[model samples]
Target: MKKTPNFKMFMFLMVVFVNTSYSQDVVYSAIFKNVNKTAENLKHHLNTSGDTLYLESKFDLNRIEIIGTDGLKTFAINNITKDIRVPLNSLPMGDYTFAVVQTEGRDDTYIYTKTIVFKISRLLPIDMDISRGITPLNASIYLAGGTIPILDLAENKIITDFPAAMDLASMEDNKPVHLDYTSMESLVALQEKENLDAKHLRTKKIDNILERNKPAYSKAYNITDIRSGNQNIQSRADYRRNNLRPNGLPYD
Candidate 1:
């Protein structure tokens, strides 16, 4: 008597064969080889003058395209040399992919494409009011450091020079404030008025603050959580308990 073939084993083998065939079919473009080789020789340097992005390429480029991470093309140029300056004052801060394509060979069949990814960041200084209970005590202490030292917790190194903070106490209440070193002096002055100990002033690493506070910020500002009926009800209850007027009415 012949034994029946193992159906499960046969099915598994068939699946493996199909997957192998599919993987073989996924071939990279021919241009990618030249693109990779040229990319190895190319070097990119990025600098910012006000809102303009100055991109310097070491190797000559046939075409350069700036594509947003979302696959939207923001800028492009053809037959450009090494130095290219792009105005990005209006563009939002985000990651973008730069594609540099070049063609070589007498027949012009050789195509090469290279991609560089980068992010744009902006530092905007705003004035903020420091109301009691509005800002955390530790954060206030950090602000008091005036030229606060930002430590990289992972590397355990100070990144940059201490920035001077200005006292904008006369500004409108509840405005956003960008605290620098001078703010530390203001904080010290406030402490003196309250007769608080100078020893209470402390500095914290930026990484530590971000790591500790990220979860709270995420929870407080999560859109999905805010939209949930249960979360809204819970938030309302918390508000009623935490905010009460002199007449015993909950602050709306």
Candidate 2:
């Protein structure tokens, strides 16, 4: 017997709900912190074909615009800061200027822009050579870097960080710095010791099994895979049962 809700009342409630929803415009700023001051500009150029320009910055980004002699391209978003992925396949080979803009609280705004030059080219290979010897194995260091990469050819692994401590930009004449062979010798010795320990543990396990099964082997079981138990199905468990004792030498 109550009065039904009318269309006018429903419409009025919806209008109030939409107005009360939370929404705000994006605002942001950025600062460059790299120490290599000799590099003149904040922007860096890339020449890869059909690649994207990943612009990374800390700011509440509203829109980023790329301005070239051809025209202007704008990318807009609602975030405070975001990566602007600019595809370069469509543009002609040349230089361009990019502008990054951000807004805060609907009124505050800021902008950063820089000119970047880029060119397209074929990638070159790198080369390598033995740099120095610190030890027998670990110390033997190799250096490689050229327009053409140096193929290892021997181990089939790309050579990286020869001097170990030096960064790429700090290398003199783009030549790799190798570590000493003394380091290599120590590594080899450690490996040999580990192998010896494993052999010793294996011998002890076989001895223990023989002792336990000797009483049973002479009577019924032949020790030829007598099915020790289902628990021995796992390689690790089998290895332990065949090599270790309840009170034997610690495996490590």
Candidate 3:
């Protein structure tokens, strides 16, 4: 038969496990990128409160100590590496301060970490070789001194050469370009001839309509004089109409 475990000891062990777990979210290293800014100039972030500060720094990889606060002394897991992630959900509920310290010897100096992390596994680009101590923080193109990013991420698709021909007459500026599809020598000449013929026919039709619609009247003249030859007589209306004058002919 097995003996029963101590209840008080079991509870104490549980508390220790919870606190240690919460303290593992913070994994840090000596920030080697970005311009150094003073504490007064740096932007600080907030915690969920009553959280235990479990900063895991380079495990003497870069050698630093931390979690010092205005009211608390934060601790770092000296065995933590550049690969371990800060488990945010495991953080303890507490008040703490964050600072950027210079950590070359043993003091934990935190600056702009210049760090970017992606948690998804196994689906990264094949050219992205962040294994055996390589990481995106040092391999991203957007960062200074970083290596070339994923081979496929270079956007080689749009580099294709599209063979295109451009015509000035088909383009638009402030003054629009109007295109005429009709061939000038053959088609335009035929069109012009057709228009002239149509106009002449229309004019003849109008003249016929006017002649039919006008009022009817008769013209006459009386013989007032006999010619010297006595073969023809002169009529006044006929004389005036038939004669040409300096001022021009009068209306009959």
TM-scores, in order shown? Answer: 0.28, 0.24, 0.17
lDDT of 3 by residue, 20-99 (tens): 54333221111211233432222222122211112233322222222322343333323323322222222233222233
Indicate the TM-score of model 3. 0.17
What's the lDDT for residue 242 in model 1? 70
Instruction: Quote the RMSD, in angstroms, for model 1.
Output: 26.1
* TM-score between candidate 1 and the true structure: 0.28
Off-target runs (Cα >4 Å) in candidate 1 are 1-40, 48-50, 103-108, 121-252
Query: RMSD for each model, in Å, please?
Result: 26.1, 25.0, 29.3
lDDT for position 64 in model 1: 49
Better of 1 and 3 by TM-score: 1
Give a tens-digit lDDT track for model 1, residues 1-252. Answer: 121255335434644643464323211100111234545545443221223344455554455455544465533343335544443333444434455543332345644555554333322111111222222111122322433232232233332445567777775777796889999999989978666443333334555677788744223332245365334233545646676767988777
Q: Which candidate number would show the highest lDDT if scored against the true structure?
A: 1
Number of the top-ranking candidate, with TM-score as the measure = 1
Q: Write the per-residue lDDT of candidate 2 for residues 65-162, one digit (tens) a residue.
A: 55556677665544443334443434454334455554433434635433232222111111111122111111112233222122232333323334
Predictions ranked by TM-score, top down?
A: 1, 2, 3
Q: After superposition, which runs of candidate 3 have C-alpha atoms over 4 Å from their true positions?
A: 1-183, 225-252
State the C-alpha lDDT per candidate: 0.41, 0.40, 0.33
Model 1 / residue 52 / CA error / Å = 2.9
